[model samples]
Target: MTVTPDIVLVLCVLLVVIILFIIDRVRVDVVGIIVMVGLPLLGLVTPQQAVSGLSSNAVVSIIAVIIIGAGLDRTGVMNRLARLILRFAGKRESRITAMVSGTVAVISGFMQNIGAAALFMPAARRIASQTGIPVAHILLPMAYCAIIGGTLTLVGSSPLILLNDLLVVQGKSYEHFGMFSMTPIGIMLIIAALIYFYLLGKKILPGCKQIRERGPLSPLLDKTYHEVGKIYEMVIPENGFTKKSLGQLRIRANYACTVLAAYNHVTHKRIVAPLSEDELSPGDCLAVVGPPMFVEKLARDFGWIYKDELKVFADDLAPANAGIMEGIVTPRSALIGKRVGDFQFRRKYGVSPLAIFMGHEITVSDLSVQTVSEGNALLLHGKWSAFHRLKDQNDLVFTEPIRGEEIREDKATAALTCLAISLFMILVLNIQLSIALFFGALCMVLSGVLSIDEAYLSVDWMTVFLLAGLIPLGLAFENTGAAKLIADSLMHMLGVPSPIVLLASIALLTSFFTLFTSNVGATVLLVPLSMNLALSCGCDPRAAAMTVALAASNTFVLPTHQVNALIMRPAGLRPIDYLKAGAGMTIIFLIVLVAGMRIFF
Candidate 1:
């Protein structure tokens, strides 16, 4: 098989994209845009096909799914589910690990994995703190569970959606797997992960001594108060700032305090990360953090009650309740390149930036002056419920546990019902998945589960655009014989004797490679090639495609994955830590993948 010039150019672009992703020098979406624009210019794919993925039903469905996830988040349904699951974890560290692993996995199948993990992280931390489980032991397993949980349904993961879409593009829509088609194998993989982590995998985990974490963010408390800053809270009287927006008050500038969350004395509810659009009502108790003197002065001037200890800031703690936690800034963090005071951290994110962690240096007390940079972790304080505001944010990930009732069952029921209707349409009515998802998103808004603006904000435009951009590369591969070339390369590397062996081999390869690059990128690059491999080998394309899709989520081995990175700083992880536990888990999962394929496929 001759490799055409088009194939060579496509392969070169693919290599460049992979390298850029691994190096962390450029953003993933930017890298994808390069491929989207480059492929057509290089004449690898026609201009029409290059932009086709942007309007594809697959991309549209994913956008709808993201909005639905947001509705679940705003409604607090997922959080309630997480808290309920946490009840079964028990006091034993091993039981806690098993339950957390399985719980997040199961819930993740229904919601976005990141959102599921976000709600559960606080619970997991609280469990670890109370039960004496090592934070390291719980965090990695939780992250892994989130990834595998998405495998249970086609809607559960991006790779699954992309694979099905690819099948449609290839005129194999009839053979596309159903919503629950991946459930059997997904359950098997999760069971294997939990069992391994519960028994044999426990030995590889760092002990409480090594992690030195009594609470997820406890180790950072000293730096928070003495180094970063201390926690503070203020109450807003109906007459003081009534009906005023956070933007109008200029409280952060006026009193030098970042407003974290507002507890309504009348409503008995705490609004976390209240948006600027939100008006300050009478009886609103705002949690703020600033210098002791400044906080006191602000309290006096506004005729508001100020609790320097942050007790009243906590929703559960009541008129006198408050608390503190840690939040890590990522590469593209909105909080970066600005001092905690200047940016009005608490006003913006609904939490005070108490301190910043830069490499080996920890700055706590003087955080207001120091500019935050990428990779810096900010320690914050406020109500546990207020922490939820931070969860919906994209730039930073919080480490502190959010205690008590997570999901608001009343509102959540509406979102869940909408999701059920969408799933019913896809599985029972055989409606186009994209159409069902779109209708579900609409229902969420109409039911008041989320406002239209909230729905728009909830979508991860980066993921949507990334999918749109990189998907055309798959078309290029198929068109230029690049897919066949890749298939031939793999066939030569591992001779195709039994189709099962070929399937397992492809799955194994995808699993290993996903540890290095974004799972979505890996999936987009390889799934088309896997389909071609199946056709060339006279094997089942559906089975081959499903294997590759599931395998793309095998992102347990490294912190390169977003879920892993989110937990790493909080867990105090090292590279070898991932290797010690992940290797065993990976090997066990490979066995399960092979067995599941042989039995189910």
Candidate 2:
């Protein structure tokens, strides 16, 4: 039989989506928009039909959730929580891993997983530096916990939103999922994950030995620039420096470093305004910034011994060790199209490229071998000595130094306020209003809880636009009648009289597609087909639709399926890590989903 024009059009569109996803050529959102508009031009869908998916409740809910997440990130509340957790973690690696992962999972249950991960990352890095623990030991668990936590709530992740929309469209009218619908399963998964980490996470993860040997600040300490500048951490020893008048020492002329700030060690209040010459005292911490040479000379002249061995300035010095250098592959970064092994990074820059924050998640086994795309954040590592030299080179864009205090302080009240707004929108108002979530996020910015620039920085606009663009394409599948055709074929092949078998088939296929393509895209494509299949089998279409929708989000086998993959790279992970950790979870989720659909739907 000759295939219809609609089938041919859908096949072509599917091919494009798959190819674009694999090649990382255009942004996925752009690709999605093209398919949505292009299919209509080909007479496969009407303009109205193509635009309908944009109105999907799922899409609206997701946008709101993202905005709400941005608000929480702005408040710096999460950072405070991380610090408190780290303080209580002690020195036991396994206990630390459990605590960090557990806390991340719990918080992510109510907020966005990526938001939680971003908030916790700096603290994790700090703990790693202070305790001489390799970041690898904690980061993977951190990412995994976020993923598991997101599975708990309807507002936690996009897949849950998609599932609810699919059910509504199928006439089941499942407006909301219970807060704890997935908690039992999620909690079980966490317990299992903790056990696995205890058994194998330590052995496979990198150790703290390298960090200890290098010293806490060794990576950032510019050994080559002897005395060019001095970063002194003077406790108000005898209050002499504090008591000395600014004019007496001529700090600006003598130190050559700007007096960045002064904090009264006793009061902990920062002295931002100009200090009166007579206000000098003995008990304050002087945060001075100036030429290394001048500071070094002054320190010697003043009997200030350089205590490089002390951890007093540990927080301030940690970023230097974890050098943040931004480099565009000028079609020649010694990294383009090369794997990690090819460059032998430790021998070259004395650091590893931790994470590549990109506009899209694409695979690259070797950094040197993979073709570099524009706008990718290559998180590089190196000794401060080598990084300074690298920073001077024209090939890489060196990021401005980020203050440790700014990062730590950024984690305050925003998360709580955002949560309050989200809860009000979902539970109290009962309006199903996504704009409320956005408004709540906006409140954070308007109230000075978070600065405008900081709020903007917190958003993953690429992902947002990608979703916006892809939603339209779902219409093409429906308008073209391609969905009906696929549904017929599926029913003929596997649609037995039993609804359970049919649901399983749809769920399994949806899960497979999700592993490779965007989960939202996977859902938009499969939901219509599964709905039709359910009708053909004389079963509730909502159940089948829910199966497909839920399955799309359960990508635990590979990093490619979810945002968790992007977070994994900085933790120094390999593909096998997902294969081991995510595989069992994927299986458990599938079992639970299938059973839940049978009983609930």
Candidate 3:
């Protein structure tokens, strides 16, 4: 049969999702909302049905889980966990590779994989810096692990939620997957990942072996003898304080300074906890700890030069036109594919690249020397006017990029508590899952885990609005007989009478679609087709729907398919790194999923 108005409308919606995914003109959530509401308005579905998708327990559960993940992140729990991992990682490449992959997998199973990667990227970078391991060696494995972990349960990702909803609507009753159902498969993937890393992962990852050599510990660490107070570095001028003893100069009494370390330029030897009565020589660099005002005054009065290289006293600068600006690198920005060193950013903008807070960790060195990637955050330090000017440049990507301060201890705690409540609500309390999530979100505010403002920030309102908007279109696909028509066409193509073949066909198509589009969008497009195919083949539609849902979550081939791609740059990964590690795992999971469905369904 020819395509109907309803079918045409559905195609148009799919086109929009694809276009947005390719060009990234708007947030994915915004696109989702447009398809959802616009389809119903075009007489595709009723208003009530359109709005009902927002109430899906699966959506609520996923959102609540994000809040919980955020809380765990804020309390320094994830960082603490990462630090522990690094301690055990030692210098062995094999051991470090395995632990990093295992950690990402475990965390991704419980929380959002994207969030898990974001939390660990900085820690991973720090560990790489300390241990002399190539960051590219660890990052791709971490991203793949998160993707694998998400496959373990229905609540692990958005695609799973869409799958669960599609199955429920298909009239087949299936248990919501356990929190760890996919763990067995996930573990197998981890083993495979370890093997890949040991063999090819180390060799193909970009960046010099010299980059893996351990560097000296941060200068600040070596300079500070005490941790309780602030430390400042001031250079003693030849005439200002030459040949004066600490007591003679009354440096402590005059400037409220406590000497932490004294560096002799001639000898290059650092004296930690220098003696109070020690004579200050010309050109001596002293590390002093005290209040900001006192430190600044001491520098000004003593004619001491200020050093920015030492973070110990870097924060004590005279606030030289300093302010924070947040921006996201657009796909089209000059930084899209350049390395940090390629740009010589410091010399160009007079701004030092501080810490990049992205879905991955782009370090100061990377920003200074390596090529830049899209969606990466560049934390700039310079005069406020310079920052404002740089921000206004066209080739730069600047939008609602999240600030570092947003991810704090309280928000992290709130996110964790919300997860706990969501777990109780989903597995134990047996209350309506959506209500449970809403309550959990409420607790984030009430219990001081997150302020009202912060709680609002934590919510991905675009996703919420998009899901709410898309739900009606999905319903319309079912109600308008479009689903049945598509199913019949697919069944005729398969030309096999077996339900198993039809199920596999549906799944394969969904997985293939997911490689290029949003997993949620893939599910919305194919769920109706799968249901129709199931009915035509005289099988339970829920079984077929579940297969497609599971397949949609299996995005291991391309970094662009999920949030995993965003981590590639910081990890210093090459394209082959993903293909080598992800290709094999994708095949394994696809096989396992088909076999599992045949037995379980």
Query: TM-scores, in order shown?
Result: 0.52, 0.55, 0.51
- Best-to-worst order by lDDT is 1, 3, 2
Model 1 clashing-pair count: 18
Per-residue lDDT tens digits for candidate 3, residues 383-409, read 344455566665565443312332354
lDDT of each: 0.69, 0.57, 0.59
Q: Candidate 1: misplaced stretches above 4 Å?
A: 90-97, 104-187, 195-410, 492-588, 595-601
The superposed Cα distance between candidate 1 and the true structure at residue 487, in angstroms, equals 1.7
TM-score of 3: 0.51
- 199: Cα error in model 3, Å: 7.5
Native-vs-model 2 lDDT?
Answer: 0.57
Number of the top lDDT candidate: 1
lDDT of 3: 0.59
